[model samples]
Target: MTRLTAALVILGLVILVTWALWQRSTAAEARADLAEQRLAESQQREAQHQMIIDSLWDNARRQANQRRALAKQQAALTRIASNRLATIEELQRENQALRAWAGTRLPDAVIRLRKRPAVTGAGAYHQSVRDPQPLQPARE
Candidate 1:
């Protein structure tokens, strides 16, 4: 009877140890799975962050290029405007010189004749037939 009881007790102890080992193994596996899930989530978040940064960099680069192009266009326009201003100043000087030369060369009588108002229609036709009167010099 004692031997039988001892054998039963030993068997029960063995079963309990096996059950404890199985529980421990299952708990360890659960912890490992949780860690793996957390790692995957962290990796995904990093990828998203990296993508956002890349997009921002690209936008900044494009804007900088546009600004550079705009500055270049403005510089070109300024250069053209300066060149046109120089040409206009030269033309004005030339016009003044020509006016001075023409004033000296043309006779006063001829200038007066050029300044006279034109008579139109019947009046103009009659004036052309009559002896023309000498035009009076204009007062400044």
Candidate 2:
């Protein structure tokens, strides 16, 4: 009976030691996999940010081209151009922030949030706001 009890105790100890060693080896692999996952997620975030910046750039470019084509021919469009310029500046600022984010490896934290414009109607012209002629009443 004493021999049997001692054998059971030895068997339990052996099993516990084996389990501990196995856990240590598996933990290292899990840590490596976690690092790889973090890298992949970072890359994906950068790609998404790049796409957003590209879209904003396209919108700003289109607005500039339209402003050029209109070229003081229409008073409403010129006001719209001013609004567009404001909008473009906002976009450029945000774009620069995103560029900085991408240039640095995606940090775990963002220092500052980007500011966005709050203009209505997508920067289209309103008859009321004549920027250059603000001193006088708007001409029909």
Candidate 3:
């Protein structure tokens, strides 16, 4: 009976030790699983953050390129406008010189007729008879 009791007590101690070992292993596995999950979540957040930063940098580069192109186009347009203004001024000067030359070259009688206001119907025939010469084109 003493041997049987001692054997039972030893068997109970072995079972308790086994249960404690199992609990400790299970707890360790749970802790490792939690740490692994946390590591995966951190990696996922870092990937997402890196993607956002890369996208922002691309957008900034595109905007800078767009701004540079716009500035170049504006400068070209400004130069074109300035050149056009100079051309217009030159045309105006040429028109003034042509008018002055025309006044000097025209016959006095034709000039006087041009200065007179148009007279309607019955008076138009009298005016036409006074200037019977065929009109001539201006010399270039």
lDDT of candidates 1 onward, in order: 0.86, 0.74, 0.86
TM-score of each: 0.63, 0.38, 0.63
> How close to the true structure is residue 28 of candidate 3, measured as C-alpha lDDT?
100
Tens digit of lDDT per residue, candidate 3, span 35-128? 9999999999999999999999999999999999999999999999999988877776889875566457667657766866576777786876
lDDT by residue (17-132, candidate 1, tens digit) is 99999999999999999999999999999999999999999999999999999999999999999999888777768898755664575667777677666767898767755736
lDDT of 1 at 115: 69
* Cα displacement (Å) at residue 31, model 1: 1.1
Q: What is candidate 1's CA lDDT for residue 96? A: 84
Between which residue pairs do clashes occur in model 1? Answer: none
The residue pairs that clash in candidate 2, if any, are: none
* Model 3, position 69: C-alpha lDDT score: 100
